[model samples]
Target: MNMHKLVKVLAPAGIAATVVTSAHVASGDDGINTVEAAESTSSNYKYQGDTGYGDGNFLLNEALIKTLEEDGDLAFNGHTIEASEDDYETRADKKSEFVEEHDQKFTLRDGTATKVVFPIQDETLSIDDVTEAYGDDFETTESKNGKYETYVYKLGDKKDDDKKNIIAFKVEDGYVTQGTIGYSKSY
Candidate 1:
């Protein structure tokens, strides 16, 4: 297995810049495959090896959202899908919006959840804890002011396709404050 690491600096005002590191593994000559760190291909995302969180599934796509709705685990927060007047080319082109319920914030694109943010609220959550829960194969960014930090773990090969899946942690004061799991068309 070969590990690749890339570092980048982004200077956004008041926000932390990023240092991204990713690992790629090659199959051995014996035909045995070594596990690559921080890779998840399933539609349902997980944190700490569990899928359920906060009265519903934490990170879900369109199909899983529908299933949760049917199972009474999720519901719309009374906000209807409305497209902007000029950008309404088609139903599929509508802008993504957030629907909050069950203490989870779901970003819906075309009535499907593309991203979900949930509260961590664990004062003991640390960077090492996040690394253990997910993996060390992640990209990290810290605030310019040194008060905030974020770690992003890739779910799939972003270089190979347009679809992006990731798990992210937002830390403040040396502790993780929140988490997010989602997918996007591009990152």
Candidate 2:
């Protein structure tokens, strides 16, 4: 049996990134077999689940990209890939932007969603309804002018010690004007 590992390091905008790949080869009575595993620890964030919009919930990661491309509810506005030194890295890494029929916007990095914004033109979500769904485990911030308030809910259990998942809603006059869901490092 033989094992090989490959590591790639990259830094963009002062952030250190690392990608690790491991391969194992074995030859015996069963002839030869190879297994490979790859992990990118560049970002401390990991996809947990949907955005908690009930039936409208959209999960992040590559599956989201594939779903949007296939789902008839969304319009394919196009996407852009980031250029890197390695061809594999360049092909694997990309930032995709998508818009729903109601004008909701989503921005994904490397197939993982980094941000989602719901426009005011869409059907307004009630703050009371959101509270009823997610409970009271959240933080609130109000604008100085008292015109807007933002409620942020930290999603995920204690098992997710390193990663942080959050869903936020911006409300005005008791109606949610916008919403955002994101995954990132805890620290």
Candidate 3:
């Protein structure tokens, strides 16, 4: 499922729902997929595991994190890639070459790109749309190293008080659509 569909199916943004208390699902063969988003941590959040790009494995820079502190916890709004006709069945099979693509960027609260092209998958989003939404205030990255094509964007506050969240999409031209949200308290 693409990030767009994941956001809607798992975490519906309606009537002000709070952070998830707990959940356990059983995905049939497709892998038990769950979208973790929406709720702010009741306690301080912490950053774990390196983003693989840096110490925290996070893609955002020091300056950008500082900026989000001035605003509310950052939330990412994505796009909708309609799956073919009214039935959601894709007529065209997804091309494997899509992995060779890449893009990345960094933006501020007002939505401006300060950096771009680190190459992460935005199957749930388009780089252009992100550029417009984040402008020149944030940073982005892209890469085709994984089994699946991937593009990404990263943003948030200081590592000690993380308020930023990540929204991502998984693209596979034909079979299914999905999304994933990664969050941290950033201590």
Candidate 4:
């Protein structure tokens, strides 16, 4: 090749190499590195592994709920579904009129058994007993309506769906009349 042609080729190649090297230096990828490590804080919330009812082992499907209402021995986890009620809500539309809306119904109940396996032989269980069984790794919320005071215990998050694992105890005259342990709407 002629000297002039050789000069043109070599000059551009050298310039391109310098530009690439400079770009690498400018972009901060030159092997020296700095990493800011972050430590995540632990949550105070504790989770229960057993989850009382048969929830830890099997899901409480609709059929099981029906069986609980119909038969007395079909128990899951440690509780049985005693009864269910349809929930209704009042809603207002664009008009000034209010309408009644039906929401998901309450589907299960413990009926005063502390994880009591069905064929509930003896009526000897109490809500306090259930609370004691759960220990300190739980949260409680209470509400009063008429003659009944409801106590809800939030055990932990559910494994199958986006719901809370809870056990509700309905008390009247300082005695637990009903108990329910199952998944409920999170919010």
Best candidate, TM-score:
1
Where does candidate 4 have its weakest 10-residue lDDT segment?
Answer: 84-93
Q: lDDT tens string, model 3, 1-187?
A: 3333333464444522333322112233566444443343431211211121222112222212322333332222221112112111121233211111112222221222111112233243343443444345533232355444323323444353223434443334421122233321110
- lDDT of candidate 4 over 35-154, digit per residue (tens): 211222211111111223221211122222222322222323222322211110111111222111121122322232212211111233454554554455544445534666656544
RMSD of each: 15.9, 17.0, 17.4, 27.1
Order candidates by lDDT, high to low. 1, 2, 4, 3
* Model 4: colliding residue pairs: 53-77, 54-76, 54-77, 110-179, 111-179
Scored against the true structure, residue 120 in model 3 reaches a CA lDDT of: 36
Instruction: Give me candidate 1's TM-score against the actual structure.
Output: 0.47
Candidate 2 per-residue lDDT, tens place, 4-24, comes to: 111111122232223322111
Query: How does candidate 3 fare on TM-score?
Result: 0.26
Q: Write the per-residue lDDT of candidate 1 for residues 1-187, one digit (tens) a residue.
A: 1110111111222222111111122345795433222322322211221112221222222222222222212222322222121112233466867677655677776775556666654564566655654557777787678778887665433353223345567778766767665543222
Q: How much lDDT does each candidate structure score?
A: 0.42, 0.41, 0.29, 0.31
Clashing pairs in 1: none
Which candidate has the top score in lDDT?
A: 1
Model 2 stretches astray by more than 4 angstroms: 1-102, 120-124, 159-162, 183-187
